[model samples]
Target: MRTAWLAERRSRSPAAHKTMDKIVTLLAKELRIQPRQAQVTLELLDGGNTVPFIARYRKERTGSLDEEQIRQVEARAQYLRNLEKRRAEILQSVAGQGKLTPGLEQQLQQATKMQELEDLYLPYRPKKQTKARLARQKGLEPLAGCIVLQQDTKETPAALGAAFVDPGKDVPDAAAAWQGALWIVAEDIADEASLRALARKTLWDGARLTAELMTDERAGKDFLLYKEY
Candidate 1:
């Protein structure tokens, strides 16, 4: 792990987050230590010095850390910088909403895990209006919350949904009730940790990269315009 951090920091294409991550993974194998442990030593030591310098000058500082380890740490640091830049941009956009509470601010600040950060950002991220948004506008949020709380399984979701309907309030009938309930259902399904995990596994495992067909054939005929697979 330490070796990977070194390679990542010393990477020539420092902006390539994906490549840097891959190098870090590879370097861990050469160093025979987990990536997390390697990362800690890299953090404690100086980074300005080149790989050769660390291999020679700071050997004692790294507990006699070796040449390959230095390379890995450098690469991982570059990866970290790229991630920091992206996180900053995302936080800046969220901050603009004027809705950021202190707990949320702290969560956003210390978000080293990508999945956790995205979960925090999901509600704020740009999106199109769907059935859920429509239901919220229709004043059925209370009923939706009841179904989702899942505290009482026998509370009859459909009956509670029926009680919340008001055509005057813009919900015309049980159809609208179901519509509102459907939105909540879909949102809950999407947000559920287990469901999301299963979906991610299935999606990544089953998904394929397909190229866009060029309607403007002349414009994209060249190989340079071709997208990665």
Candidate 2:
């Protein structure tokens, strides 16, 4: 509970959360509990006061959580604070772009992950070459929409797609028109908040951690340490 709470608090970030997670792992190792289970206890133990003070004064309640564990918890807590700070910066950047819609804002607030936020921001974030941008330059948005609504019971997709193909607008064919529309639909589905939430739930609950030694690099000779996340 403690570890998970801290992790949830830090989930919006990448670099900082990653550092914090490592510290949490160290704390867990010191305390002899799995990292998944230690985060909550570490959070609770570090909720208030200094490490020296906590170690000296609150030993009995924390299962004798020692100086090392206290240090690990404090380091993890500081990293989490940094993650929140960076998240604010990222949000401000996105907002400044004038592309932050209400739905996008809602997703940003509810996102449990930096990767998901990045993915959600991909459409709005500046990029040089994309199919939609090129298609729009060729003036294909309306034609695309026409094909997208082709499934309407009142009008056929092919008929609607055919009706809007302005040769002057560079709409090459019904296929090209619908292809652009399909791109939009795919991005919308990928960035949907509900879809993201379900996927995140699966990642948190279904994923398992694995690790291996760093034998080929700088630590090849060191029996002292080798680890993976």
Candidate 3:
């Protein structure tokens, strides 16, 4: 079993040195420790030393970081390792779909957080039948492009949409075509990474939380304090 496990570990893909460097730098900065300390801590972690064991027995190696600090280092290392794995998977999937442009590849490579990477990948991800897909299927993508450009101030939106109406595509009139185009635009805006990041920050900064009692009678009052909050 040990031999097989060793072989499996050896066969696993190695993460890039650049990613490890970034993680070490982040650990040093966030933990307010020396770079050598962070590097030694990661080595200990990779050697199967638990946080408690490292804190208790490996004081000289880790510069006497406490258990809590050792644990934080372990957690952050694991998070960055997982982030690198996810980044590779996303790149492979996008490349497979032939939609991976140079700019997009660069963005994926530079993304530091899982949420940022996921937001960038949203538009490229495959989905089931959605409003955007339905609109594209009905040949309304041209109208959608026109709406996105917004360059033709002389032509009304309805007039621009009227040109795409085809009986075979089930577009009965300009209004239906325009609606479908709007749906496509909405999906595009929702998938935009910058817009999503901005919206998330806005909500995080401004949103408030509230709790309410399930009923007037409190059979179990364990959560009674939460009702008033």
Candidate 4:
């Protein structure tokens, strides 16, 4: 009944229809159900029907999905909707800042999780007053870029940075300019999403957690096995 009511009352735009189709396909794949089942279930849920109501009164419409199955679908649908909303907002924010490139837009569109979206946006997000921002303000960003490019150059680090040293810019000497440039490079490396993701995966896959003994022998007698862990 609610599904029929939804069909009668709702009129979605083509973009909204596309979003719904994507949601349906994702739901079907994740929940291991047929596309028709996922579609009907999402429609019924959107019509303000409860889990028990769908499991009981709308069994036929839901393709006999149990209450647990409907609940999982509801949860996944909410997450996916939130993800899409956030993706749109991030895109708009970056575009407003004139930093959205075609590749970046594609990456944002392809992000499946909240973490992925946040990681991709890390470099563009408003940052605090950090060394990198300070260095950029002092006109040391070009030096930082040159260092990052790692091109073959006859000039040594000190010689390269010597050109940027200016008392008016607060860079007292080549050493100071090099320091600020290194700070900027460090922050750039930290903000890179791909490097961060790779490092995180490497750590998680190979890292170990161990408990160390920090108390006296008498106090730690109960967990002697973990003393050397």
| Shift of residue 1 alpha carbon in model 3, Å | 13
| Quality of model 1 by C-alpha lDDT | 0.66
lDDT of 4 by residue, 1-229 (tens): 7667667547777877888899999999999999999989887887778899899999888889999999999999999999988998899999999999999999999999999999999999988899889999999999999988988999898899999999998999999998999999999998899998998999999998988889998998998888878
User: What residue runs in model 1 are displaced by over 4 Å at the alpha carbon?
Assistant: 1-67, 150-159, 166-170, 192-229
Candidate 3 lDDT over residue span 6-51, tens digit each: 5654665555656677789989998999888998888777767788
What lDDT does each candidate get? 0.66, 0.64, 0.87, 0.91
Question: What lDDT score goes with residue 136 in model 3?
Answer: 95
What count of clashes does model 2 give?
5
- Which residues of candidate 2, in runs, are more than 4 Å off? 1-65, 101-112, 142-151, 197-229
lDDT of 2 by residue, 1-229 (tens): 5566556776656765665676566557755756754565465554545677667876665566677776766665565455455566667878898777887788776654556666666556667776767677766666656544654457666765666566677666777667776665565566565677688899999998876765665655554343554
Error of 4 at 9 (Å): 6.3
- Candidate 4 or 3, higher lDDT: 4
Task: Output the better candidate (1/3) by TM-score.
Answer: 3
Of models 1 and 3, which has the larger lDDT? 3
**TM-score against native, each model:** 0.51, 0.50, 0.83, 0.88
Quote the lDDT for 9 in model 4.
Answer: 44
Q: How does candidate 3 score on lDDT?
A: 0.87
Best model number under TM-score? 4
